[model samples]
Structures are given as C-alpha cells and as structure tokens.
Target: MKANVGTLDRGLRIAAGLILIGLSLSGVIGLWGWIGVVPLATGLFSFCPAYSLLGLNTCRNRPH
Candidate 1:
C-alpha cells in the first residue's frame, strides 16, 4: 500500500497509540485504550484503510 500517512501524522499516531497502550497496560486508561493498537499498526505500517477508501493521503507529494 502507498504511504498515505506522513511523518508528522505517523509520529502523532505512534505517540498517541503508545500512550493509549501504556495507559491501558498501566490500568489507567481502561478497555477503550485497546483501540490504540489500530493507530499503532497504521502508523507503524504507514497505511490506513479508511484513508484509502476516503481518497485521503497524508503523505501526498512526499518522496520516500
């Protein structure tokens, strides 16, 4: 898949995901934090299915 997630977007997603995971593991965020894995995976892979279906590209014009 094309990299529809840019550096900044990926970074944010990763950070948010890590926080959610951390909080959940620490018993501070509850079960909702489990959803963070989705963003984590998307950021780690630089691809998001929703973005693809919506014709969105956060990494547009980016080289690499």
Candidate 2:
C-alpha cells in the first residue's frame, strides 16, 4: 500500500495512539482504549483502509 498518511497525519496518529494506549494501561479509559491500535498500525504502515474506501489520500506525492 502506498503511503496515504502524510508526515503530520502520521505523527498525530502515533501520538494519539500512544495516548490512548497509555490511558488504557493506566486504567483511565478501560479496554476501549485498545482501539488505539488501529491508528497506531495505520500510522506505522502509512495506509488507512477507511481512507481508501472513502477515496481519500493525504500524501502529497500520490499518483493520479
């Protein structure tokens, strides 16, 4: 998969994911916080399935 997630987007995703995971681990948000794994994986992989389904791409160099 091409990198549909840009640098800023990826950074934010990673940060948010970490925060959610941290909160979950700390018992501040319960198991639902584990959902952060989705964003974390997408950020690290630079691809978002939902974005693809919605025909959206954040990468600047995406091909036409």
Candidate 3:
C-alpha cells in the first residue's frame, strides 16, 4: 500500500490517538479509548483503507 496519509493528517491522527490512549491508560476515560489505536496504526502505516476506497489521497500529488 502506498502512503495515503499526508503529513498534517498523520500528525493529527497521531495526536488524537495518543490522547485517547493516554486518557484510557490514565483512567480518565473508558477502555474504549484504546480504540484510538486504529487511527494511530493507520497513521503510522500511512495507509488508510477507507481513503483508498473513497479515492481520497491526503499524500502529495505526483507528476504523471
């Protein structure tokens, strides 16, 4: 899979995911906070399946 996640999107996802995980770990939120791992993993991988299906590319445009 190619990198469909752009820098900004990846940063946001990582930030949000980290916050979720942190909250859960700190008992500030429910275990559901761990669900943020999904976005985190996707951000790390830079490949989002939904983006692929939707033809949404957050990554930079390449020359044809």
Query: What is the TM-score of each predicted model, taking all chains together?
Result: 0.89, 0.93, 0.92
Model 2 stretches with alpha carbons more than 4 Å out? none
Whole-model lDDT, model 1:
0.91
- Residue range 3-60, candidate 1, lDDT tens digits: 8998899999999999999999999979999899999999999999999899888895
In order, the Cα lDDT scores of the candidates are: 0.91, 0.92, 0.91
Off by over 4 Å in 1: 60-64
State the weakest 10-residue window (summed lDDT) of model 1: 55-64
Show pairs that collide, candidate 1: none
Error of 2 at 44 (Å): 0.4
Model 2 error, position 15 (Å)? 0.5
Number of backbone clashes in candidate 3: 0
Enumerate clash totals for all models, in the order shown.
0, 0, 0
Candidate 2, after superposition: displacement of residue 1 in Å?
1.3
Which lDDT value does model 1 have at 16?
A: 93
Q: Candidate 2 at residue 38, lDDT?
A: 90
Cα deviation of 9, candidate 1, in Å: 0.3
